[model samples]
Target: MKQRGGAYDPFDCKHYPEADVVMRPGMPLAMACTGEKARIVMLAGGRGMHQRLTSMGLGVGSEIEIIRRGSPGPFLIATGNTRLAIGAAMAHKIMVIPMEREIE
Candidate 1:
């Protein structure tokens, strides 16, 4: 994956190279399924995008849950006690590592 600006730690994301990053370890938050929990790993945008996400309490390492999946409008996500409706376009700029659910 060709990220714009964000820290890339091998330990955090594993052995996927920059070119192949989009295939494994992490994926765009927009692609994540509803009800899934994910951790923000990278912001594939410039400083402005980073600042915007940060102001919304969404940054690297932040754990979030997908509340609603959106095909046209904004999608909803919950972080801590806050629920945010992020635009589809902005969601594409946020890369996340989807956490696997434990079998009960």
Candidate 2:
């Protein structure tokens, strides 16, 4: 079969869609883009009770997404089902998935 320009050919293992567009909004970004490893360093900030949410086992290292940004900006993170609301400031420091490869 013939393929268009740049489209991935699953059989060839040559094309990667993500390679072209690295980071994007409203989605989780790869750690490699941030130069951070599995262990990300971040500060706490968000809702007035953001610090309190930190202790809820949904901060740093956990996969999260930028749901929105504003005076009451909130994060829509997948921590089970509840949408975790993290302040934009804290989101800036808190990095997710480390780019380091796992050792065998």
Candidate 3:
């Protein structure tokens, strides 16, 4: 049985091996093309950054659709019913697996 609010380590790919079996390997969010949908796999940042993103519903396992890709500006992404614009540098720290393909 799973414990609620226990030591949940979302970064452990072993616990979420289905992500790899169904989708491609992870890639930086900034590298994903515009209009692509992907699931967040990892976040490479400190506590504050994690809190900021989590507050905006961008934590690991969240599915996001890229609305626009900004090379030198903030990138627009849609998560749930909310749309967020994050800076390029920040987006680069988020690793995600594209959901555009599925393995049979």
Candidate 4:
């Protein structure tokens, strides 16, 4: 709900509906899924935000991926290219979609 950047009112996203966010597979994510873990190839934020995100292991080139959504909610996530477990509360702060896997 909080818009990290000033491009839009921070409060606007709070009211934004889930359906509005685009979730095309392989496309860059516009927002975090309610219960899907998304691999974070990069993070978009300034200093303070960056620091906070880093605490959650969300940083540039970290490569966090969505595993699955929990029965209650928030979805299980894999963090870093290392692939650690993370909860949805932390994922919500991130705005991401999906990326097409690179062909080896």
Q: List TM-scores for all candidates, in order.
A: 0.73, 0.35, 0.72, 0.39
Instruction: List, residue by residue over 23-86, the lDDT tens digit for candidate 4.
Output: 3234333344434544555443467767976776666555555666444554556664454444
Q: What is the lDDT of residue 6 in candidate 1?
A: 82
The TM-score measured for candidate 1 stands at 0.73
lDDT values for all models: 0.85, 0.44, 0.85, 0.51
Q: State the local distance difference test value for candidate 1.
A: 0.85
Worst 10 residues of 2 by lDDT: 25-34
- In order of TM-score, best first, we have 1, 3, 4, 2
- Candidate 2 per-residue lDDT, tens place, 1-104, comes to 24558674544444635543444222232222322324333433456435665666665445433334334444444454555555555555454444354234
- Tens digits of per-residue lDDT for model 3 on 1-104? 24447865444556567554465448889999999999998887799999999898789889999999988889999998999998999888898988876344
Query: For residue 61, what is the lDDT in candidate 4?
Result: 54
lDDT of 1 by residue, 11-50 (tens): 3454665556445447899999999999988888899999
State model 3's lDDT: 0.85
Best by TM-score: 1
Candidate 2 or 1, higher TM-score: 1
In candidate 3, which residue pairs clash?
Answer: none
Query: Which of 3 and 4 is the better model by lDDT?
Result: 3
Cα error, residue 12 of model 2, in Å, equals 50
* TM-score of model 4 vs. true structure: 0.39
By the lDDT metric, which is better: model 1 or model 2?
1
Error of 2 at 17 (Å): 38
